[model samples]
Target: MSYRLPARPRARFSYTRWQQRFAPYLFVSPFFILFLVFALFPLLFSLYLAFHLWSPLDGLGNWKFVGFENFALALGAQDLFWQTLKNTVWIGLLAGVPQHLVALPLAFVIHQSLRRYQSTLSTILFLPYITNAVAIAIVFATLYSERLGLLNYARGAFGLDPVRWLGDPGMVPYSVAAVVFWRYLGWNVVLYLSGLQAISEDVYEAATVDGAGRWQQFWYITLPLLRPMMFYAFTLTIVGNMQLFEEPFMLLNDGGGSGGAGLTTAMHIFNTAFRDLDLGYASAMSWLLFLAIFALSMVNNLLFSRGGER
Candidate 1:
């Protein structure tokens, strides 16, 4: 009896079964944990900070509950908020309108006329989108030089006077917009190209048999079918243009250069938060800008949904 065999490790499958059930969760847990600590926490903190007055200088827990004061200050007539908004919209339209305008036709051309060279052309076009923003801005800055720049040289060749690209306030926005357009043009082209490729050739063949011309096919078939992709591309453009920074910042420097024509809402927020040490004000401005972006996105959604229904 005393020599009774120790109970065999019979069917102790709990640990193995549990691990099998939860291994995926264990693997994915780190992402959610990191996201909670880094993204969700900071977002909530920023929202809280938006309603209160505090700076890093004031230390943690010293924030004063100022309610809507920060919002009021930003939206007040005296603040630079309105001007920045206007600048942002202007540059956004300048860059965004033409981006789609040019990208659509360019993609159509490549898809229809340059089938054999699609890969090469796409790679060439996509280069700018992948290029470093700072590098692009710096190179563009030199090209925009009023005196000895290539642009001015070209103007001189045309017997026209040199235009101050970054220097003149009137031209600064356009200059910045041009760079933005160039950088994003290829991205949109690629998006449209992918959309075009996904379209069934049978549809186009049927249209062709029905005597549809190139323009008619594009207008009726291509554009209509490409709506989903267009919506996606347009949404990207809207969000990206609203957050315009880096290029303008690098090209014009932190001060936004000459009359602050190139100063976007993002730049203003950065200056307020970091340079001026007004964290709460900047947070409020950010939330306001976010609201504006949301409103615009909703409008776009309504437009697309209505078109889809029609």
Candidate 2:
């Protein structure tokens, strides 16, 4: 009778414990759910559509399996995909190269000279980046007008003939590139400014004590230290420029202005998918563009890595 005395205590549920166990997950669940519904679903569907010939007119189940035919057509010599790709690359180089060249030095100057006004200047520089894309494009379209535009007006004031900034085939790419450059230049400057700020003042002081001149310190110290940020900014520019659409679309219209000179791969893909109603081919071309962007990004990464190692 004495041996059977003690009874075990059962576990009790606590609201606090339950909340602690699942609160973080519950908070994050909305993002994952939305991502699955919106992002992942669309991405997977686009990939599936890439292999099938279907139009919205044909509806969902009427799709016919075409395998890699779409990809083949995009890569073929007769297709406009290659030309659009060339245009895209040319415009990207025009805009992207100068962005870094200007931003790095500009940021360096601001960082060194205008520390007191840094916040105000950063805000001003960032205004364009934050501005609406459509609005920017529209304004730029007005400025790029052949005769009535401010730019041509300036040229005319200088006793120059009003050049067709957006009309000439040779000038269309440069025109589009200029807009892209103006819009993104400030963003790169802000990025470089941030990078410059992260650098230690002690390093500069040490260099100064060791008799290193400003230019020498900048060339040897600042640039090397800023490599990571440069790599980041370059990757963004490459990716953004590769997918460029709205500026060209708005400024040049869907046909990409005279001779299709401003037709970027993105605009081409849009026309293929929407205007031409060849969704399958467009999807395939999209994947191809993705591959191109990825390849360029990898090359940029490799260059940066090599520079770092050296």
Candidate 3:
């Protein structure tokens, strides 16, 4: 008779081995857990709230389902939403257009000529962007003050009338836009500078060898290469400006100053949600604003992509 082969031993499961296998997931689980609790939950709840008429004072689970009435009201001619949206777009254009116009050239100048002092200059330019918005707004409010303000004092010294920077409805939008422009101009410059730095020096050198002038090289090469950064910066500007609230809110107060001239869509939404306690309508308006921002961003992307292809 042939000898029987030895039976193989079964491997038993070890708790330590299992722990080691899942250790990384265990370590990362807290972040996902927190996101689910805070961020994701609030977002889902807001969408739910958009369809129901519920006030915080009314207690939870007492909301009346209103279907699409909230959205319809916001979009209808009877609401201030359209006017506030118009104000937002106007101020956005006023602030955003000049930012790119100035930043691109300023960045080009800094990149080409100020290499030795780039870091120092960049830091100085970036100060406004990093400064507290509330503090900046407070200071600007003083500057925009009609009587005792520095701007008006200068006007007096020049034998000109003291302008109503914040009082006149016609001037409110411009005043608010000025603050937005000053705060974000430096940030755009920094973005453009980074874009300029990433460009290859050889391309410029080759252009120089080909007898292309500085203006020509910049127009043909730099601009084409900088398209991606321009798109990114433009997208940020669109989103930020559309949701503009801080400067106007701080300068003009919750009522939006005289004629509600400086009231942006964001400010309007805030007033609706908190002041009037119409959370549902405010939520609908917020989602609509989100859609508008998304559409503008898509248009920006499309333009840049087309430019890149050409």
Query: Which tens-of-lDDT digit does each residue in 1-310 have in candidate 1?
Result: 3788688776766988988999989999999999999999988888999999999998999999999999999999999999999999999999999999999989999999999999999999999999998899879988999988999999999999999999999999999999999999999999999999999999999999999999999999999899889989999999999999888999998778799999999999999999998898899999999999999988888888864552
> How close is each model in CA RMSD to the real structure?
3.2, 2.7, 3.0
As a whole number from 0 to 100, the lDDT of residue 139 in candidate 2 is 93
The local distance difference test score of model 3 is 0.92
lDDT of 2 by residue, 20-137 (tens): 9998899999999999999999899999999999999998899999999999999999999999999999999999999899989989989998989889988888888889988998
> 1-310 in candidate 3: lDDT tens per residue?
8999999999899989989999889999999999999999988888898899999999998999999999999999989999999999999999999989998998898898898888888888899999998899889989988988999999999999999999999999899999999899999999999999999999999999999998998899999999889989999999999999988998999888889999999999999999999898899999899999999988888888874552
TM-score of each: 0.94, 0.93, 0.93
Q: Rate the local accuracy (lDDT) of all candidates.
A: 0.93, 0.93, 0.92
Which runs of model 3 end up more than 4 angstroms from their true locations? 1-16, 307-310
The top-ranked prediction according to TM-score is: 1
Query: How big is the RMSD of model 2?
Result: 2.7
- lDDT: worst 10-residue window of model 1: 301-310
Higher-scoring candidate on TM-score, 1 or 2: 1
Worst 10 residues of 3 by lDDT: 301-310
